[model samples]
Target: MLSTPISLPTVFVGAAIIFLFALALYPSSLLRWFQRKRYQYEVTFSLYMLTPTEKFIFNSILFLFLAMVSIAVALYLPRHVRIIAHRAYYYVSGDLVKNGTTSAVLGTTAEILTPTTVAEAIGSA
Candidate 1:
């Protein structure tokens, strides 16, 4: 008996389908983790009351620092295959596009346009 070898495209699509399935099923847990990591400092700060000026200054500094750190990490982090795999899983399986949650959360025309820019560039030009 002989079995046919799976073509690369089929394998890739299959992997994407499986990843999406996982994301759909377990997105809450993934989201919880992402929220914890992303807003941990904000959660900590919520315990204190802040005057308007203090709030503005604190948030401005915190966000600036976060932006810088995020950029630095994006540039310096090791490009690991597993990270790519997980992100691929999230993008394919996550309800980001189908449910339109990402756009709703981003709440800006520019944010909405950004994904289209990437997709169009990658798909057609």
Candidate 2:
């Protein structure tokens, strides 16, 4: 059977047989898959269904985990970077207040920015 040449029709028939057998074994699953949902909701398990004590414990553990992660991040990351990020996040000045742009400018800005002292432009490279 394994060595036999398999065609589409033979494979399909075998699948149909298996599916029909499965339909008998698990009618609800088959129905859910084949049937259009009358109302848009599914019967499923959820943690929200947990008891009051379980929910409290779960939330406590979750918050504790989140706090630990927050503290770790705060501790692991340097202070200056955090300050810069915070400032960047809050800064609403909007793009340097002037769109300083130049078309077809290749390192001309670098030349302008570099100060020429004693007839020798400070080595850019």
Q: Tens-digit lDDT track for model 1 on 9-114?
A: 9989999999999887778876889878757665678724667688789888988999999998887675555456556765777533333334344443343355
Q: Relative to the true structure, how large is the alpha-carbon lDDT of every model? A: 0.66, 0.55
Off by over 4 Å in 2: 1-45, 79-125
Each model's number of backbone clashes?
Answer: 1, 0
Model 2's alpha-carbon lDDT is 0.55
Q: Model 2, 1-125: lDDT tens per residue?
A: 57978899998999999998987887786487655352232223244467868767876897899999899888877765765654565365332212133211222433233234312433433
RMSD of each: 26.4, 16.6
**After superposing candidate 1, which stretches have Cα over 4 Å from the reference?**
1-43, 46-48, 79-125
Could you tell me the lDDT of residue 5 within candidate 1? Answer: 81
Q: What global local distance difference test value does model 1 have?
A: 0.66
In candidate 2, list every pair of residues with a backbone clash.
Answer: none
In model 1, pairs of residues that clash are 20-93
